[model samples]
Every structure is written in structure tokens, then in C-alpha cells.
Target: MKNINSKKLLPINMNSIIEGHMVIIKPISKKEINKTYLSWLNDSQINKYLEVRHNKQTINGIFDYVNSHRSRENSEVFAIFTKKGIHIGNIGVIYDKDNKYVEYGIMIGNKKAQMLGLGGEATILMFEFLFKNKGFRKIFNGVISKNESSWKLFESIGSTREGILRGQCICSSKKPCDVYLYGILRKEWLNSRKKYLNILKNIKIKNG
Candidate 1:
């Protein structure tokens, strides 16, 4: 991975906070790492699609991972919070400065947060921050083909099905699965932002 030159990035608050109607994204802190967070990583149901599921998770290791992201110039991780300030999940991005693109992964660790469209809200907020604020040209997301909900979340937000790598990943099923690649160019996101925004709004209404 290319190291991001801090000077090359546009000036933005290190403590940047992105707010949506249902969820918020902000830099995660040590205080947010707790028993519940640890449980999420260890839970088979929650981490089934996560690469981290291959290894055991420990409190110390999770803390170390978060700290590493803090110090890494090319990447950052943020806690996904609800409007009520509940820390339900996490989202992270790694920048490829030379290519002017970003790739991200997210987890809605809290079961209560799943299937409610909050993930989509959180994703859109992140995309808005990356494309509009950070000036990234494209955003890329990859999901195990079995994780239909995940890829569909990206699609609902206007991402295109770019490509697939057959049997690229070993999943929790103990078998290999295809990795579905999805992406959205900055121009495409800009053009369809409003339409998807309304779709998400209606989801909130229906689920509310």
C-alpha cells in the first residue's frame, strides 16, 4: 500500500464527524473498545463474512489494530454510531493516493443495526465524505459472493458490479467463494446522489 503524504491531503479536521439522518461516522476512540465490541468480533454470526473471522480476536489485538490505523498515513477507521449515539459498528478506508481511489470495508456488528438500512446511510455518508471532501475519484468495495446483503447495500447506493474474482476468498463455510467487486466513480455518485438519498429516506420511513 502506498503511504499517504499528509501534506497532499486537503485540510480537514482530524476529528471529522459525518452525520446522516439515522447514523453518524466519527473517529473511533479507545473508550469505544469494550466488552460488547469484543463480542462482536468473536461472534461467528457477526464476523462470518469478515476476514478477521479466520483468527481469534482478543481485546489487546483489537486495540492494537485500531491504534495501527491511527498511525498509518494511508488509512483511518471510524466507529459507526446511531443518531442516539450508540456505537453499533465500524467502517474504515484505505487511500491509494497515487491512483486517487479508495477502498473501504464496513461491519454492522450490532444485530439490531442490521437489515434496517442504517448501513446504507452510513455508507452514503462515508462516500460523501470521501468523494466530496477528500477528493477521491472512485470508491471500491469487495464482498464475498455469499454475502448478498453486503453487495446489495453497495448497489442500492448506486455502485456498479465491476467484476468478480472466482473463488478468491475462503469463507466461513470452509469453502472458497467468489469475491464480487463493486465500485462507483465520483461523477456517477454525484449524479445519482439525490435519487439514492431519497430511497434511503423512504427506507427509514418504512422501517421506522
Candidate 2:
């Protein structure tokens, strides 16, 4: 992507609470319900680390899921789209209004979309929305120990590995695997967001 054309890198849409230089993060609509999206959930290689791996998911189930999501009052579900408008993945937060913190989850189900740092960028975009826009005090997630890249993205953005459960849950293998619990406070992000965004800006995303 070195010396790429400037036009291709420009964002095609600018409507959002948090818009990054790479991807467009917006609310996941019922319109996103379809077979193309279902294929992502059913693909073993892509869903291997996801909770849905336990069951064979279908289009009707996904359709019902999205429809149900629309009625959710505490969950903030967002669909990830490339600057070119390709629906590549979804990111969401399970808002704990009583506790005033949220659990973050992300999935770049399209294999073609992984490994380009796009996932991290999408994470940051959603992070900004939760912290900067929504004024959340803290954000956290449980990362499968085998999924190093997943937790690394959180750590890179100043999230602390609070603790680890020894073989508490299995992911990616028949054997049990530890899950790393990570958390980041708003103050931490306020201090680190600038540096992280600058580093991300220097890294170019390749068109998949």
C-alpha cells in the first residue's frame, strides 16, 4: 500500500459518532441480515474463537438474532464496513448500565479482512465511541489465551491484564485454555489515545 492513491484511502461516508481514517463504524441494522453475513458465522475457520463455534448457525437464526438486536436497549451493536462500503465484521458492547462499564466484542469474520491491522483500528473506533462519546468509565474483555493478537490489541491501547483464569474455558482446541481478562479506564485511554492513533495513522491498510 506504499504510495497508494489518495482517493482510495478517503472515507466514502462520514456519518458516525466515531469515524476513523480506515473503517466506518455504524450501528448494525436489520438490513445486514442475509446469507453472506451468515456464511461468516458458519465458517469454522473464522468462527473458531467465537462463542458461536459450539453450534452450527443458520441464516434464519442470524436473521432472528439481528432482529432481536434491534430491540436491545443495553447493547450497542455496530457493523464494520470498509471505506469502500464492504460489510466485513461486527463490533458490539454489552453495556452494564448499573455498573457503568461495558464488555467489548469484535469479529472480523472475513478471512480476507484479517491480518491487516483493520481489526485493531475497528477496536479503537469503537473504543472512542464508548469512552469519548458515551463517557464510559471503563471497558473490558476476556481474551482466549491462544488468541494472542486479540488481547495484544487491547494491551497496545493501554489495557491492563487484570488477571487470568487457569483453563477456565476452551477455545480453538479440545483442551481447556485460560482466558485473559483485560480492562482499561477512561483516564488511561485519554492519556494513550493520541499516541495510539498516531501510530495507527502511520500504518497503511492494504485493500483486500
Candidate 3:
């Protein structure tokens, strides 16, 4: 990566939001709910590591969940879609208003769309939104220790591993796994965004 140039850095007040090559992050709405995205909760493979997917899910139940989340003032939930408008996943930040921080999460629900760097792009866009638009200074996230790939993803985006909760989550094989906590400060993001944006700029969008 080259040194970030003042000209190449992203503008803080850009009007268009959620633009990306492999994916687009659109605010979650009742109108966007569908069988594909809804099925993710019921899919054992897709929801293996997610705490919210532990119970059985129905269309009505999922609908209620979305409605309840939308009612919140501090949540910024969004549906992750492919450039061609195919729904693949969701991502968002849960704000801790009193503490002046946020906890973030993301999921790429479609198995067919996994491993294509779509989730990574959606995450970067969401982080940029939090830091630039929403005025959030501290952002935090966690990944199951068993899920090495996810931890790597966060590290690649410049998050620092702060702590670990051992044996907190029971895994698919019935073994307890740790959850690795990571965080990003505003100063770190200011530096990281430049390198990340450069990478995004160089990435070739296949029919995006």
C-alpha cells in the first residue's frame, strides 16, 4: 500500500452512502424482507456462530424482530445486497449511547455468495458510515475464536484485539469456544480508511 494522498482520501460529507463494488448496504426495511434473507436464521450452516439464530424462526417471528429493531433509536441496521440487487446478508451497529461507543455485527447469509469478499466490502462501508456520518468515535466487535477467518477479516480492516472471553460459546461440535473482542478508535480509522479506500479503488468490480 502506498502512502495516502490528501486527494485520494474519501470526503467526509459525501452525499451518496453505502456504495461498494461487490455489495451495497441498504438500510433495513419491511419492504426488503424476503424468503432468502429470512431463511438464513433457520439454516444451520449459515447461523452456526450467531447467538440470535439459536431458536427456531418463522416468517412472522422474523417480521416482528425486524419491526422491533426498527423501533429503536440507536440501531443502524441494513441489508447487504449484491451489486446486481441480490440479497446476501445484513450488517449494522448497536449504539451504546450512554457510553459513547457502539457494538457492530454483520452476516453474509447466502452460502452461494460466501468467500467472495462481499462481506468485507459491506463492513468497510458500514464502519465509514459510523465514523464519518454518525460521529461515532469508538467502535467494537467480536468473533468466535473458532472462527479464525472472521478474526482475520477484522484485523485486515485495522481493528485491535483487545480481549477474549474464554469458553463463552458452545460450538457446533459441542465444544466451548472463546469470543475475541476487537475495537477501532477514531484515530486508527482516520489512518486505516486511507489504505482501505486505496484497496477499494484498485479492486475490480465484476459487472458491479
Identify the candidate with maximal lDDT: 1
lDDT of 3: 0.73
> Per-residue lDDT of 9-99 in model 3, one digit per residue for the tens?
2111222346666776666655556676668888888888887656887666655555444444556567787879888888766777688
Clashing residue pairs in candidate 1 are none
Write candidate 2's Cα lDDT for 67-173 as tens digits.
Answer: 34334445656688888888889876776768889888899987888999888888876776678767889998998888888988889988999999999876767
Note the clash tally of each candidate.
0, 0, 0
User: Of 1 and 2, which scores higher on TM-score?
Assistant: 1
Q: Which is the better candidate, 2 or 3, if ranked by TM-score? A: 3
**Who wins the TM-score comparison?**
1
Task: Give candidate 3's total backbone clashes.
Answer: 0
Give the CA lDDT, 0 to 100, for residue 89 in model 3: 85
Model 2, residue 116: C-alpha shift (Å) = 0.7
- Give the TM-score of each candidate: 0.86, 0.83, 0.83
Ordered list by TM-score, greatest first: 1, 3, 2
Name the lDDT value of residue 164 in candidate 1. Answer: 95
Q: Write the per-residue lDDT of candidate 1 for residues 58-131, one digit (tens) a residue.
A: 77777666655555455677898888999999987877767878888999999998999888888877887787
**Clashes by residue pair, model 2:** none
lDDT at residue 47 of model 3 (Cα atoms): 82
